[model samples]
Target: MLAKRINGALRHVPAWPLYIVAVVPPVWLLWQGLTGGLGVEPIKALEHELGELALQLLIAGLCITPLRRFAGVNLLRYRRAVGLIAFFYVVLHLLVWLVLDVQILSQIWADIIKRPYITVGMAAFVLLIPLAATSNNASIRKLGGKRWRQLHKLVYAAALLGGVHFLMLVKGFQIEPLIYLAIIVGLLALRLPLATGARQRA
Candidate 1:
């Protein structure tokens, strides 16, 4: 089967290399922004680019389980790397908004409170903090497997908020964000039966 072949090939691929490869996109994006390749509004373009990458990575993280359950492709080992990279992009997105886009320190909190999209984005970012902090093996051992799994479930909420944040932040009715939201929702739906099965087993 194709999946078996792919899985067989994946066995030789180390997850660590993904971390090294992940550095390329942000570096390229920053280079483009600096070179004015991002267009007239370079800062805004860079901010949006980082934010979109973050959302894409979040959606990728959500896809891992469904891909394994339905498609017979195991990415369990890469999930942590996927998640941490997503969180990395999320932090980069927030920093670009803070340091480059909005330099005013006082307005950061004000924007979070006043702007609906920013509020949603901040909420999603905050939820990821604990998950990112505990993505390590030591944290897993310390927290216990069950508790660690529970804590990581926060990604679902964060993913939902991330989709909504993108949807709301866009200037008008945009198909891209809507597509992203739909994919996120569909991925979440795929996990429902798995959760139910686990509950039944318990």
Candidate 2:
């Protein structure tokens, strides 16, 4: 069954494009950083870019199931890839802030502790770490389906936290983060009715 599924996924889409597409943004960032095209403060640009990418990827990951269900495309196969990429962006976001912006390890730790936005962002990223770690089929099988599903539900919290982080990160409360927040809420709300109905039936 697994082999058939793997073969079907490979036939459905080529993998190389996905990999290449994923690397494009970071490569661009590296080039910009080297060329000093990232404004007066390249570090700030790097931090902001990474955070935006993380948020964008988080939005994409949350949209996968809804898009699949609504469009009847069965693109859940791409969910893990989307999620892991999101996780990578988040790691980049945090690392740039820690290494470039904060410079001092103690300051970075203190910033995470003191700043509510950073605190939420770090929480979201930490939540993603486990999800990314268990993204592989082997880990999924080892954990069993039920446990795996439960663990993955952490994505909801991570998404919510990510949106909150962005909302707080903005210079002022902006519509962009609110829009992302609404989408996250709507996607999550879409799940509850069915789960509730199933329980009522049982």
Candidate 3:
């Protein structure tokens, strides 16, 4: 029964073309920016693009469980890649701020300490580093499944921090950040003890 279940899940997941779908948006954004068609402030455009990518990846990471359980696609295999992409764009977003806006390490550090948004964003990025580093089959085997799962739970917190950072960075409340916050909330809700307990008994 277990073997058949796993096979059924595998059969439901679409082919590898789905990976390309994930890569296309960033590529198109870069192409648009390079062609001088993004917007008046290209740096701002780049920053927003990278930030959006980070948020999208966070949402995609959260969707894995629902896709697996609801659609029976077992999309957990893509979660690590989605998480690493989140970290990658987060690094780019930080670099844009450091290089284009702040221009000095001392100033950047000062802003992180003084500005709540910067602090939260920095905290999220910092948490992502270890998760990204250890996101591999080999690392999972080394850490054992239980410890690995516990450590990776930090993603939920990191996603929250990312949402808060974006919310505070905006001049006022906006739809984009609100959407991200809602998605994060929903995803985290799905991971609550109640749902997990049900899954365990299933």
Candidate 4:
């Protein structure tokens, strides 16, 4: 009953407001970086925060399917907004690395080629571009349901790559990155055919 009520209320809540709310953290991080509040390596701090935020948002979007299936909580309406917000942060993260950290175009290319984490991160970002571009009703209509869904499956790859990128970028067996990787793996496990089939038939 409580879930029903929450779902009903969500029907009236506009997704635009959520987008506005989602923009706050990145802006705040930027402001803090500009004001020396991000400690010694502000650029690195800002980049890390933006990438983490993107990962968090992607995980949140991934949760929508399981939430509706098991918890009776529906958030399908906000999934697109969540995804776009994730993509936006990803763009910011890449920009910071390219323009602020590396600055030199040749060095950026060299880093992407030499650094395994950067290569993985770039691949994940590249996968996300088509997904972000086709996230609309028009694209849905044009591509049809099955094809669109198949295309969006790129997200699973992106998520796994993102997790691996983060893990490798940390360069150690840090608990936090390990935890995030575990969560991503768990989420993927939940989406396996057996689990999804059982949930659907339930």
Candidate 5:
């Protein structure tokens, strides 16, 4: 009943408002970073925050389908905005690493090639490119729904890579990264049709 009410209310809500609100956090983070509020390692702090936000948004976007299917909470209207915001943060995170953390072009390329985490992160970002680019009605009409969905399925790969990247980037046995990895794995598992098949067989 509560889900129905929320879903009904959401139908009237515009996605543009969400986009406007979403821009605030990154702007605030940038201000804080510039004003020395991020402490001694401001660049690293800013990069970590942006990367984490991106991952969280990606996870939230992934949750939409599951929420509608399992809990009857429809949020299809905002999924595009959530995905675009996730990509925006991802781009910002990459920029901060490239411009602030590793200013040298050769060193940046070397890190991407030499570091495993950086390699995975770069791969995830690359996968997001097509999805972000084609997120429009015109692209949908041009490519057709089936092809568009297939292309967007790359999101699962990107999400998995993102989880691994986060896990590997943190030093030692950190519980936070492990938790994020576990959440990503759980969400992916929920999307599998195996459970339904097994239940039917039983």
Candidate 6:
């Protein structure tokens, strides 16, 4: 089968390369900012790009299970790396916003309280902290497989809030953020057992 062939090819592909490749983007973005490539508002552009990349990674992570179950394309091996990189991007985005954009701690706190999108984004970031902290064999053994799976389910909520945060932050009827939110909702819907059962037929 094609999936078997793909899986075989993927077997030789190590996860470590993913980490190395993922590092390139942020480094490139930083270089761009320094070189006047990210435009006048370099910090804001950096933050926005990182946040969007994080959202895209979240979407890709959500697709992994569905792809394996429905299409027989097993990428379970790289899921952890993808998830960790996504969390890293999320942290980078927050740092750009906090350290570069809003240096004042009090103002940052006030913005988190006053801006609905920032609140939602911050909530998503909070949800990701534990997941990022425990993305390893040690944490899996410490928490056990079942409990760890339960804890990681928080990714769904984080992903949803990320989409919503994007939608809320953009003014007017922006199609891009709307598409992101719709894709997130659709991916979440695919996780329902009923959806699986229906796909399997009556």
Identify the runs in model 3 with alpha carbons over 4 angstroms from their true place.
1-28, 197-202
Model 1 C-alpha lDDT per residue in residues 89-163, reported as the tens digit of each score: 999889999999999999998999999989999999999999999999999999999999889999999999999
lDDT of each: 0.91, 0.82, 0.82, 0.91, 0.92, 0.95
Residue 122 local lDDT, model 3: 91
Candidate 5 overall Cα lDDT vs. reference? 0.92
Error of 3 at 33 (Å): 3.1
Model 6 off-target regions past 4 Å? 198-202
Question: What tens-digit string does per-residue lDDT give for candidate 4 at 109-187?
Answer: 9988999999999999999999999999999999998899899989989988999999998755689988888988888
How many clashes does each candidate structure show, in the order listed? Answer: 0, 0, 0, 0, 0, 0
Worst-scoring 10-residue span by lDDT in model 1: 193-202
Global CA lDDT of candidate 3, please?
0.82
Q: Please, what are the lDDT tens digits per residue for candidate 3 over residues 1-202?
A: 5645875767656544555675776677778877887886777888888887898888888898766665555767667778887887888788888897678888888998999988999999999898999988899999998899889989889999999888888885579888889889988887777766675632
Write model 2 residue lDDT over 108-161, tens digit each, in one string.
Answer: 889889999999998998899899999999998999988998999999999999
lDDT of 5 by residue, 81-162 (tens): 9999999999999999999999999999999999999999999999999999999999999999989988998999999999
Candidate 3 global TM-score:
0.84
Give the best candidate by lDDT: 6
Better of 4 and 6 by lDDT: 6
Who is ahead in lDDT, 5 or 6? 6
The C-alpha stretches of model 4 lying farther than 4 A from their native spots are 198-202
Quote the RMSD, in angstroms, for model 1: 1.6
Q: Estimate TM-scores for all models.
A: 0.95, 0.87, 0.84, 0.95, 0.95, 0.96
